[model samples]
Each structure stands twice: as structure tokens, then as C-alpha cells.
Target: MKRICILVIVLYVSMTLCGCFGPGISDYRYDLATGYQLICSSAHEIKVVPKSSVGIPMIPAKVVEIVFDDTFILAKQLGLKKESENSTYMIPDEKVIRYWIINAKENKIYGPFENDEFNKKQKELKISDSLKLKDVDSYKKSK
Candidate 1:
């Protein structure tokens, strides 16, 4: 009876231990390779909101690499007003624009255009209480 009990306990322990080595997400995924789906935990998805001098243009984007990935990122914006005198188009009906990226979570800026004054109104936005970035070496030692 004692041997039987020990065997049952050992089998239960082994079964639990075997599950620990099951499938787990790696740091990165290579979808192009092996022709199989890959999921990664470390890889993060980000989006950029491009801007133009005239205003925000309609463009489709998929991915972007952030220079710095920190919880607390600061965003500075500027507003532009277009004036047309005598229909001469002082600002030109179509003016050149520059593009910049916005966070994926930030969708208000890309929500929709109410009127021509969309880009004319600029505001400052920031994300606080985010985990600041640290070098790889420093991160390993961090608690």
C-alpha cells in the first residue's frame, strides 16, 4: 500500500512538471520563416500619425519603430491657420506638409475631420505613469 501511494504521488508530480515545458511565447516571432504562425510576448505593436503642413492627410500605415519606448512620452503640437485673400490662396489650396508619428493608443487625432479647421487647432498631450525606459544592462539588475 505504501508503494502504491508513492507511485501515485510521483505520477501526479511528474504530470505537473511536464506541463511547465509546454508551448510558450518567445521574445520574437518570424512569420516569414517555417510558414507557421508565431507569437511573441516582447514584441509590441505601435502606430504613427503622419502630419502635413496643410493638415493631416489620408494615408494608411501598418507599423512603426519608436525611437524611445517609455511609459511617459511627451508630445508637442502646433496649429496652423490658412488664409485666402481675394481667392489668391495666400496659404495655397495645397501646401506642403510634414509627417510625425503618434502613439497607437492615441486615436483622437485621427478620429475624423469635422471641418477645415482640424489641423488649425493644436494641443499638447502626454502619457504619464508609464514605465520609463532603461538600458538592457540596467534592466536586468532592476528589482
Candidate 2:
């Protein structure tokens, strides 16, 4: 009986470490575009997947909000850069809000850029100036 118990314990630990018992996605926020989704794996982790499919390269972020037009998706996110680089954890290295852009037509994604960099890319991409990030403070208050 003791040997059987030990075996069971080992099996459970192995499964847990291998992600067989990992946290499932807690929420899914879909885009109007077919197959685009923002999945909240946890409060601190959001994943942007192409075609709503896992295993493809995705943008990892903690999203405050996302807006979409016919051509593009703009998300106001935090921890995007850190999450993308370090796949092992979902913690935010910095609490800074950054802008990420996705070109729906091309199926391409752009940076978790700072204000200056985002502005530069904004012009280069010809993203409409009217597309604005909703104020983070206001979002928090409303929530």
C-alpha cells in the first residue's frame, strides 16, 4: 500500500510539472475578425493568438483594453515584452502600459512599444490618429 501511494504521488507531481494539470485559460475575449482572440490565462497574463489557435506564435500581455478597426488591432497592454521573452513565468517585470499593434490582413504583430516608439510606428503604419488608447486610470476606476 505504501509503495502504491508513493507511485501515485510521483505520477501526480510529474503531471503537474509537465503542465498536464496547469491552469486552464480563465477567460476569452474575442475580436470581430474571425479567429482572433485575447485569452486571459490569469489576471496577469493575456495571450493573443492567431486564428484562435494555440501553438502558433502569440503575443503575451496583460491587457487593459483592445480596439479594432477593419484593418488592425491595437491593444493597450502591460508585461508584453517580458512575457513574450520569458515563457516560463507570467509575472510583470514592469507595470508600464505599452501599445501593441496587429495587422489583420498580414497576420503580423508589432511591438509593446513606449509612447515615442509607438508614435513613430503609428505614422509609419498609417494607423489613424483617432484610434486612441482608453485611459488606464479611468478603466481601473470603472472596473
Candidate 3:
């Protein structure tokens, strides 16, 4: 009995020291219509859904990064439709227009905004450089 207990304790300590008992860190990339984003987190995985298709069953593309970063969010807002969807005629639903970003520290979202206003805000934030889209194809193919 004593030997068995010792063995179990040793195994537990080894596993804990090796980080087997803790959530492991992961790196993710997101692909958006405008560009790609990269995220590092310990969460199981990131999820992305088209703003138009929320709550509806759809195969979400394996996106790499969060879309709520300055550039991608602005792009989404600029693309929002003016009309609403009706049962008889499917007008694009403006309510579904949104962009979101999630990470260990922040869960930020951006809703629709006018083009000129959004541009001005981005410039003021000094995040315009971060908005430039990366070579998504290289990352996608490397994966």
C-alpha cells in the first residue's frame, strides 16, 4: 500500500510539473474578407460566424484571427446594408451586421458605422497600420 501511494503521488507531481494538469496555450489565425488576424490564447479555440448568419446552422470557415481588430471591424461596418429583410422579399438584415474579437483579455465588438466616421475614428486610434490585410494565402497554405 505504501509503495502504491508513493507511485501515484510521483506520477501526479510529474504530470503537474509538465503542465499536463493545466490548459495549454494555443495560437490561432483568423481570415476575414479584408484580411487576416492572429491571436494567442489558452482557450480551446476561437469561433467566427458571418454577421448575417448568426443562430442559423452553417459550416463556419476555419478562420485564424479575431475580426474585432480596428481594420476588419471598420470594413464590416462600411459594408452594412441600409435595408431590412422581410419574409416575402429577402432584404439584407442590417441587424446582423457586426464584428467581434475575443482573447484572454478582451471581448470587443464593433457594430455598423458610417464610412467617413469610421475612417476618422480608426485614424485617431492609430490602429490604421494594424488594419492592413496580411498575405492570407501563405498562412492558409502553410497550415
Candidate 4:
């Protein structure tokens, strides 16, 4: 019947659309000492803890999009070799002044923002800061 055919067509279209917007693959982590955290989806959707007056208060994170070249600069700043295969680096506790997001895919730098600027940018983005930093145990669990 015509109704049956229409129902089947609608079902097929719905299934197709669902597939297009399926769940994304992402990685999340936090730095042990500074409590800086990052969530990366597709190497583009990167979010970090916004600068705040309180030290290590785990809320109000900010999102920034970085490009590929920034990764190299970050490595250099962190005393990493440009061609090193290692992906993660930790900063000394005393030097943990600002957090940054390096977009490995596009090679752009996003942060090094002061607390006030970071918070301002977060407001401009209009994104809720629901993401939280993973403690040492939680970070280890992910690995």
C-alpha cells in the first residue's frame, strides 16, 4: 500500500540522518600539577581550563581552536625537540602561568591568555563551562 511504502521511505531517511550525526570520538585529560585540562575531538575541538583567581578550581573551562604550526612552537617552548614523537609534555609547577591549546592538525596556537582575558573570551564564545579537569587518578585511568 502507499502508506506502507511511505513509512519505509521515512524510516530509511531517518536512519541515514542519524548516521550523519553519530557520536564523536574524543580524548580528555588534565595536567597533574597545574590542573590544566583539555578535551579534544577531531584535533580541532579543543577546550582548556580558563584562567581564574583561585588555583586549581576545576570549572569554567574555555574552548579555543588551534592550528598545526602552534604544536611545534609549543614543543619548543616546552623544551621538546621539534621532530620528537612524544605527544604530551608537562610544565614545571613554577612556570604554570597560562594554559594553551595547540591544534596539531592546523598548527595554530590558541592561548597563553591571562585570567581576565581568558574569562572574557569564554563569555564571548557563549559556551557553558561544563567540562572538568581529571585528577591524577582519573588521568591515569584513561591511559
Candidate 5:
């Protein structure tokens, strides 16, 4: 019984130290400044939360990817609309990839838009076309 208890304790301690049961930030990347961070907390959740330097920005849905990062941040979020229970429109849920942008320079944020709307907003904001969205995994691998 003593040996069995010691073995169980050792296993639990090893797992905990290895982060198997940790619910902490798994991926964190910088955007524009030191205080600005794009974070993915917990491997199981698999979502990104942009932490702004200026103030707290609220994001409604789970962000899947951080597409662009500079003075401005563009992210792909999961789920924006849901089909009404009684309505005719059958909008798919979670299948749609919504876009969100955060202007760290100006402390302004815009979000949860379709592709066209996002483009239009980009143009309106006079953001440079040179800055492009990137594949998060590929970008990480190259570094």
C-alpha cells in the first residue's frame, strides 16, 4: 500500500510538472508593442485573445488565428451568427470564419465581420496593402 501510494504521487507530480493538466497560456506572441500580446490560453480551448497596450478590448467569439499583426491586428474568429430557431434564414454556426481588427496605434477596434466588410473597413481605415495576413503555423516554423 505504501509503494502504491508513492507511485501514484510521483505520477501525479510528473504530469503536473509536464503541464498535462495546466490551464495556462499555451501560445503568446507580440503584436506592436511590449504590452500588446496575442495569447492562446489552454491547448484544449484553442483560441486567441489579443491583449492591447492601450486598454482592454473585448472579443465576442473564439479567435482561431492571428492573421495580421503590426500597429493593426487582424484575426480570424470562430462563429458570428447562428440560425434563428423560428426564422427562414439558415445561417451556419462555427462554419463561418469571422474577421476582427484591432488598431493598437489608435486604440480602436473593429470586428466580427465577413471578408468583404473587413476589406471595406481596411480601405476606410487607410491601412497599407503591404501588410498581409500570414499562416500562423508556417510563420512559427520558419523562426
Candidate 6:
């Protein structure tokens, strides 16, 4: 009995040390109904409907990844290792008629919407509180 108890304690310690469980977990990448490929806190449950929302800028509604940090000064200093001279080309900011991701951060989305975080064409919508939002995953799978 003594040997068995010691062995169990050792095993438990080993398992704990090996991260059998703890708060050192981070899920920074997961897909969402909006198709944004969210890299947000999975601990927070995303709602089928957002109470309020914001807009995306630059790129088209469905397009991902817009805007390049083409610092002209950096290019001039480093002589641009292999970047194209026109690669950093930027257009003047216009009306918020589109939505796009801001580089690899992914969640920094921007788009035109009257009230929700997602767009109808980009995601399924359900009528609620005078607005619409992406359908929940469970709800979407059934259809």
C-alpha cells in the first residue's frame, strides 16, 4: 500500500509538471461564422447576434488582408531587400464601403454595416432587435 501510494503521488506530480492541466493555454486561432478566421479568446463565447458593431476599411467586403506597411523611408534606407517598389502602393482612404483584415492580426476587421459586426453576404443573418448578426455555428450546421 505504501509503495502504491508513493507511485501514485509521483505520477500525479509528473503529470502536473507536464501540463496535465493549468491556465497556460491559449487558443489564438479558430474559425467563425463570419469567416474571419478569428484569433481571439476562445474562452469568450461569440454571440449569434452582436448588440452593436463596427466597420471594416480598405479592402472589399469578402476580401482578406489589405494595407501594407510600405514605409517609403524604410525602403529608401534598406534599398528594399527584395520588395517591389510598387508593392507598398496605397490608395487614399474613401468612404467605408468595404471590409478587410488588418494584416495577420485578423480580428481587426472593418466593414460597412448599419448595426452588426458581420455583413449579410459574408455571413448568415437572423432578424433580431432591429438588426442582424452571423448565425451561430450550431444553428448554421443544421441548415
- Which candidate number maximizes lDDT? 2
lDDT of 1 by residue, 1-143 (tens): 99999999999999888767644333332221111212222222112223223343222221211122321122212222245544532231222322232332332233222223323322333333252323222211111
What residue pairs clash in candidate 4, if any at all? 67-106, 67-107, 67-108, 68-106, 68-107, 68-108, 69-107, 70-107
- Give per-model TM-scores: 0.23, 0.59, 0.29, 0.29, 0.61, 0.27
Worst 10 residues of 6 by lDDT: 71-80
Flag regions of model 1 displaced more than 4 Å: 24-30, 33-37, 40-143
Model 6, residue 5: what's the lDDT? 100
Residues forming the 10-long window of minimal summed lDDT in candidate 5: 134-143
Question: Listing every candidate in turn, what is its Cα RMSD in Å to the true structure after a full C-alpha superposition?
Answer: 19.7, 7.4, 13.7, 15.7, 6.3, 16.6
Candidate 6 per-residue lDDT, tens place, 19-111, comes to 645333543333333323332223232211111244421222122122122110000000112135566532323333333223222324333
lDDT of 1 at 43: 22
Judge candidate 2 at residue 46 and give its lDDT: 64
| TM-score for predicted model 6 compared with the true structure | 0.27
Model 3, residue 97: C-alpha shift (Å) = 9.0
Runs of candidate 5 exceeding 4 Å displacement = 1-34, 44-55, 58-61, 80-93, 139-143
Candidate order by lDDT, decreasing, is 2, 5, 4, 3, 1, 6
Provide the overall lDDT of each model, using Cα atoms, as 2-decimal numbers: 0.30, 0.66, 0.38, 0.38, 0.59, 0.30
For 1-143, candidate 2 gives per-residue lDDT tens digits of 99999999999998777764555534444543445665665667665667645554456666766666787777777754434665765566565778788887777778878878878988999999887765322321110
List where candidate 6 sits over 4 angstroms from the true fold.
17-28, 31-36, 40-42, 45-132, 135-143
In candidate 4, position 136 carries an lDDT of 23
Better of 4 and 6 by TM-score: 4
